[model samples]
Target: MSSSNKQAGSLNEKAGISSPEITNASAISQIKNKRRQQPSAEELISGIISGNRTTLSRAITLIESTNQDHTEKANQVIKGCLSEANKSIRIGITGVPGVGKSTFIEAFGKHLTSLGKKVAVLAVDPSSSLSHGSILGDKTRMEELVKDENAFIRPSASGETLGGVARKTRESIILCEAAGFDVIIIETVGVGQSETAVHSMVDFFLLLKISGAGDELQGIKRGIMEMADAIVINKADGDNIKKANLAKIEFNRALHLFPSKKSTWQPKVTTCSAITKDGISDIWETISQYFELTHETGYFDEKRKEQNQFWMIETINEHLKSDFFNNPKILSQLDETKKAVQNNEISPFAAAQILLDKYKKI
Candidate 1:
């Protein structure tokens, strides 16, 4: 051993202080054998722009993390990505349960990749308030697309966001676009008000349907259909083919009844078989035509701008509500006010005004 090391060890022993168990040689080896340091935010953005899949995945994970440290880092990564200025066709696909949404997405995503488009699928899964977790079953459902090198699939929980989409989905899309994906598909939890939320964000909204059911019309809200750019009927093979065609005709008639969208493009209805892969191209053609017409009319860009504005306002309102209710002073006051209203001491609005006044004071 070196003289200095021997002297240090001797002094430590004399003083009853234990020396570190690691020898200099072991320390050196440890340094040499250490895992590579993690890349910085800029490095991650660079890697993502270069189409590095692992880095892309890491960036997405960072974005999804709820921790404060992760949030700051995720913001940095997302900010760096925004400079790439990648614009993609954002599509929202929604259907009631059993409408083959997953199968259709798998097939549609593969089709986009085949056409030299980098496709990213963001799936919103139902959340359980009791567990605070989601099924996260999109990966399992889209096995084929999961293996495709050109496709990226991220399944996220709805997480108390009544909109049927994960809160960070818009941010996730920004990351994927920066990673160079040209086609982004958002699949909602189901066909409800969630459809309205998805419709607000996407360029083309497609509603998937199935045929030969007693309550086929009951499952799909007419308001949801009005928002759709196209309604696609899945499982259009085997004995279901004739029934699927009949349903398509019925939906076409139903769609004609609604006022035309601002885009001025008539929503098309078609049948597809995610299992058999029938009528896949037709759906693409319909989407392509919608984009072409909307872009030509300038409504496409206008809609996106409106959506951004809406989101900005929505986010601000959400934060205000969250902050007011979560304020330390407000929480206790709210608790008292709730009992007051329950006991007929105050009207509901009066109780709410009390909390708002308290929030303002705080």
Candidate 2:
């Protein structure tokens, strides 16, 4: 032992007091979180399907990787897991900052686990557009849920995506489902396009709002309000109870102004206090009722199929857009086209057509 530690131990011994060893919790946690041993893609697929949480987590990390080989491997893992997907209750939750999303998720996830359900949370944390930095910090907030044996929580950075969701969230959901999670909750990076991106992949979309904020209409846009299957007014306890109820009424009235959805399920509004664990069950009951009604209507399966088709087209569009922009011919002419358009030597449409023709020739 070092002299300082020996002296301290000697003093404790002389005083008949036992000394306890200390641990560096944060350092130990960081060491354990290091990337696991790399295995074959087949191994990863099999491990995930076998319900290995570490392997499942590694598979998600692989999918989130930017490396080309990692991406190819990730695709193989996703392909192997497809048959196991479309079996869970996919719910997307979104609200502005400070709306208690993380707290609600922890409470809600624990509730699900209590009912013998496996819950997976895909939380998107905002990333800096320039430096590509993000804390991916929401996991730290859900200490209890993180320790739950049946729960898996992954915090992803929403880098450069306008929707404020990870680019590979859909693939992550498939991996989670293949790992046998029955409840998949996607928490967005606050409101806006992130909610819509989440809505495209989820079976039900829920918008969380708070009270004493312009009656719950100040921050939320009309389209988002219309897309919400349920609007929850959080912080309903203590002094906020009356305000929460009033906000709930206003939200319900506003939702009534929108046309009915194709699924025939009318949107609803309610209040909840995540801190006190009050009304959490009611919100879940609302989700259960939604699933029951949608399944009975056959809209549930139809929506999933529609989502698949949408993603197929989206993939093609993204691929073609990337290919076109990355073409050397397009790059060579882009500056020329811009100059011509700016100098009035050629119309913008004409310049675009010229570049398109040049790209086609190449």
Q: lDDT winner among the candidates?
A: 2
Sequence-dependent TM-score of model 2: 0.85
- What does the lDDT come to for candidate 2? 0.87
Top-TM-score structure, candidate number: 1
Off by over 4 Å in 2: 1-37, 328-352
In candidate 2, which residue pairs get closer than 3 Å at backbone N, Cα or C atoms, i.e. clash? none
User: What RMSD does each model have against the real structure?
Assistant: 6.7, 8.2
- Please give the range of 10 consecutive residues that has the lowest summed lDDT in model 2: 7-16
lDDT of each: 0.85, 0.87
Question: What are the TM-scores, per candidate, against the unseen true structure?
Answer: 0.85, 0.85
| Per-residue alpha-carbon lDDT of candidate 1 for residues 244-353, written as tens digits (9 for 90 to 100) | 99998889888899997899999999999998888998899899999899999999999989998998898788668767866788876777788889999999998888
Q: Give the clashing residue pairs of candidate 1, or none.
A: none
